[model samples]
Target: MNNEQRLLLLEKAKQFFRDEIVESHITRACAKAGKLSNYNVNPFLFKYLANFLKGNDDPRSIAEALVLPRVLGSSINTSFGMRIQKLISELFEGFGSTTPGIDIEFIDAIDGSKKYCQLKSGPNTINHDDVETIFGHFQGTINLGRTNNLNIGINDMIVGVIYGEEIELSSHYKRINERYPVIIGKSFWHRLTGKDDFYFELIDAVGDVALEVDGTKVLEETIDALSIEIEAKFS
Candidate 1:
């Protein structure tokens, strides 16, 4: 569907669940969640309803629960940017997808640069014990030794990039020698999921991107656009 069509569909879907219903769901959800101030009301309520109405239920329910606030904040009623940012920050720090049950340290140790950059922001340390707070979340971990040793050359680094919901891209460094040896290792693992599929790439030293995940070139522009969005948001 086109962008407009998709938007319209989302709006229509959102309209199916009015504010009253959402509010009611939130009330019940808050009670069920009980004193969890940082709890995501939308997802909680969505899952609750999904438990009752089990058919073709997707993340749309959760998305719809967000629409009202999104609209209100987008309108002249309020500046939802900060609130949205706060929610996102909490979601990531408290319940980000990177590590579902186990929280990883989001340290400001490096940037896009391949050097020991000063830690501008403090690291967010998460431990394994904090997983049960969120019911459904998972993530994978890559085990690379502490030493700068690897089966591959120091310059040769294999990496996996996860995009959107479930889109994962695995590729090796094209120019390992030209870049620093940074190992994206996992100290722990968590259960996390996504909607988008993964794209695996084996990057050679010559900067060539080889599709390692199912050899197929889908909409390259779409992927480029998605990456641009991630960079813009993360940068």
Candidate 2:
């Protein structure tokens, strides 16, 4: 995209995020700034008002909407949080003994970013990459795991099934062709949250639900790349 097109897309995305997340904060800040401006507005400081407005209305929508996860690693251990676990349990209950549980050790929450809940178990070993791939098929048949106390976020995620299977590490690596990537599609996100907002959709991309990440490799990579772009722009 050209600079102009990029800027336009950014504005549209920004407006959408502002409408969803930060409108109240912006309004309050502007109100306070306006009050100060009306009083003894110092000449040098008056110029800052315009700059402040520019900062408030950032051109990148994703950037404006981006909410960072706490860098200090944490877990969701509340009663309401486990509701997600229950949801997962129900989702996978009919899927032939697929036990899904959340892994609190690696939970990360970021607005406008995919919230990943690391799920682990025996009999099936679904790793991070596998989880990313399975979530691609939200509309189709999926078996979500059963667990209680899943945390809620602007976007939410849950744990699915994990079972171990014998594998030739060398062969597996060769099959990946130097790209051990997990692909998730936009359709899957839409199925999860029914919205094009990337972050919100990603939050719900877990549980007993399983999508073929390998099958949707191209689209998944595209979506992930776009996510990276959005993150960088916002950062």
TM-score winner? 2
Question: lDDT by residue for model 1 over 79-155, one digit each (tens)?
Answer: 22213223223323443333223233232222311111110010111123422222122111222322335232222
- Expressed as tens digits, the lDDT of each residue in 1-235 for candidate 2 is 2446434434443443344223322333223322222234344643344345345423232221221110001111122133433433333232222223333212222234433343333222333465335344221112231224333331344332222222322333233323322113332223333344543322333221122122233323333433455445434
The lDDT for every candidate, in the order shown, is 0.26, 0.31
- Model 2 scores a C-alpha lDDT of 0.31
| Candidate 2 Cα outliers beyond 4 Å, as residue runs | 24-180, 183-235
Pick the lDDT winner.
2
Q: TM-score per candidate, in order? A: 0.15, 0.18
Candidate 1 similarity to native, TM-score: 0.15
Query: What C-alpha lDDT does candidate 1 achieve relative to the native structure?
Result: 0.26
Q: What is the number of backbone collisions in each predicted candidate, taken in the order shown?
A: 27, 35
Off by over 4 Å in 1: 2-4, 16-21, 33-164, 167-235
